[model samples]
Target: MAEKPGLVKTRQERVETRLRQRQVYNERMSKKRRARPRSLNIGDVVLMKNRRPGSKFKTRFESGMWAVTRVKGTLVTVTKGDEVVTRNISCFKRYHGAPADHQESGNNSDHEEGECEFGRVGGTAEHWLASGNLQMGEGLAAQKTTTPGSPVPNQDDVPAEAPAEGSNSEATRRSGLGRYNLRSRLTLPERLRDYVCE
Candidate 1:
């Protein structure tokens, strides 16, 4: 049987949509490739705009900056406002703004390898570990342990389990590793540190 006119239009629309999306993606990728740096690290703030209606700031810096809180290969984690962004080093740095807490968070060690987007002098995981700040490759929140003002573990390498909802991870104590819902953005470690500040 011959194709129906409705089906033809529908198929055409789908093809058009796919082509448009692919074009946009290609443009973005090429732009990133042209702009990426040799190395990338944590704590760099990207300058990309992600403004919406009724938002506070328009620019990334004014919007609280996109801090390169975590880095692992092409996947670099950055945060600005309520938005947590993860992208490749080149893509992120190309549009990233100035960082927040660049020095304190980025350069935990003096003699180490790799770059830190947050600070000028990049260090290594070992350096950060030596400083007693817990960090992972990516996806780490700015939270600390009992000593206060520490970084949260990025993944299950440390195995931080989130408390079974309803139970207050903070006020209520648990035996094992976990990430308690302490704040809108921060996990239990950051919340614990805030508790100290308070």
Candidate 2:
């Protein structure tokens, strides 16, 4: 009966030691881990992670935006149009803009009038090029000519000049093969230069 008290004391000591070790391990791991965002709420917009197989250039999140309908602890329920999905908060990234409903209704006055859903003030890249607002190899030139407060000039107003004769810039821009061609002109090693074909 006297040995029972000693055994209980030893077991208590071991349990206390293990608890201390566990606490230390948890503190170390918490420092390396990223804190989850706790500001998520209903009506907030967020983008869900995309798991589809794609090239390296593909976006990490889906293009379609989802609005948070319900937030239950770590799980968030989102809806995009007719589609509804419930996923963990870790799978979502908070979107920083007005909700789609406000944007569609034109109730958001922060955006310019007639701004496209994609946020382009004007039309597409082709439209900009056709309007002579943009040109090949002259994007920087246009920016340079305009002062900080001055408006950009139309490319149509200024005549286009032909590139200098024998200039490799145009060739390099048209085909990447020109850059590789320069490697062939490098002098061969001394040992390889002495060998001549019959």
Which lDDT value does model 2 have at 134?
21
Model 2 CA deviation exceeding 4 Å by range: 1-32, 98-184, 191-198
Q: Residues 1-198, candidate 1, lDDT per residue (tens digit)? A: 887676555777899999999999988998987854446555443544343435554443232335567877677877644567776554543332222223344355753355453334443333333343332212222322212234444556676677676465654434333444244444467546656432
Clashes of each: 16, 0
Estimate the TM-score of every prediction.
0.24, 0.45
* Residue range 104-125, candidate 2, lDDT tens digits: 4434465556654322334232
Q: Model 1 Cα displacement at 153 (Å)?
A: 45
Candidate 1: Cα lDDT at 111: 37
